[model samples]
Target: MLTFSFLLVIFLLTILLAVFDMMILDFSIWEALINLYFPEVATGRSFVYTGVFFGFVICIVGDFRLYKKKKLKKNHAERDGSP
Candidate 1:
């Protein structure tokens, strides 16, 4: 359930960011990501993609870490016979 919600939120936010990029920078999500690697080939948009990509990576990594920690704590509690 938590994973589902996280994915849903991420999907919606990614779409929102992509739309904003298109409206303000005139580029799709794919183009923005590509531009990060090949600036000379995919020039036009600003450096917003760098932040967006980094934010995405951070969010995903943080979420996974939190989920894993929670799961481990739950297992530990169960092993210790705690409620």
Candidate 2:
């Protein structure tokens, strides 16, 4: 469970960082970030718009499931007489 949680956090953080990098690229802010991770593609040659949109959807679903899981765990603990 600990290892899984650590990897999940890293995955979420990486996606979030990529999203941030995309947002900044719109206004051309953070050239260093772009150069380091996301090198420039040719003009009008892109696929990231769809990817970012799906990222948001995935994040929403992930959050909802995470909340549900926590809530379920809390209920189980309470049923077991946890203080």
Candidate 3:
């Protein structure tokens, strides 16, 4: 759960940074995202975008695991009849 929370925070921070870049740097978020995932040529921006994407994937996986764990616990509690 801690890892999930930490990754979620990082993912959110990266999104905030991307928004800042879009507003202040006047760059297209769509372009950065497309190039990052489907790169024809390597650029420094691609690296940052990659980190953002990787963080997003990690957060999603972590959240899924946490959800499954919580669901399993709920099922067990219900089965045991311990309200």
Candidate 4:
């Protein structure tokens, strides 16, 4: 329940950030992530773009959260296995 709410907030914020990036910066985070892995996708002034930055921020936050959850679960399982 708590994790679900946290994830929901994160997803909503990401959506808002993406919309802001598109409206203000004029680009899609999805497009930028593709361009990040494949530079040939979206070129020219790419370094100054917002999509890649937003994608990076969103991915990092999400990864950090999932890592925390995974670690917690693994520790729980280890303790359960111990005794």
TM-score of each: 0.46, 0.44, 0.50, 0.40
Cα RMSD to the true fold for all candidates: 6.6, 8.7, 5.9, 9.1
The residue-by-residue lDDT of candidate 2 on 13-83, one tens digit each, is 76677667668765343553455356665554356656755766677778778889999999999999965
Stretches of candidate 3 above 4 Å error?
Answer: 1-42
Task: Please write out the lDDT profile of model 1 over residues 4-83, one tens digit for every residue.
Answer: 56568977876776677677888877886555346686554446667656766777788889989999999998999964
lDDT of 4: 0.68
Query: Per-model C-alpha lDDT, please?
Result: 0.71, 0.65, 0.73, 0.68
lDDT of 4 by residue, 1-83 (tens): 44455557867876776666667766788864444345655566567556656766676777789889999999999999995
Q: For model 3, where is the 10-residue window of minimal lDDT? A: 30-39
Q: lDDT per residue, candidate 3, 1-83, as tens digits? A: 65567767877876776677678767698765554346687657767878867877787787889899999999998999964
Identify the candidate with maximal TM-score.
3
Task: Name the regions of candidate 1 deviating beyond 4 angstroms.
Answer: 1-46
Please report, as a residue range, the 10-residue window in candidate 2 with the lowest summed lDDT.
27-36
lDDT of 4 at 33: 40
Error of 2 at 5 (Å): 15
Q: How close is candidate 4 to the true structure, as a TM-score?
A: 0.40
TM-score of candidate 1 relative to the true fold: 0.46
Clash pairs for candidate 2: none
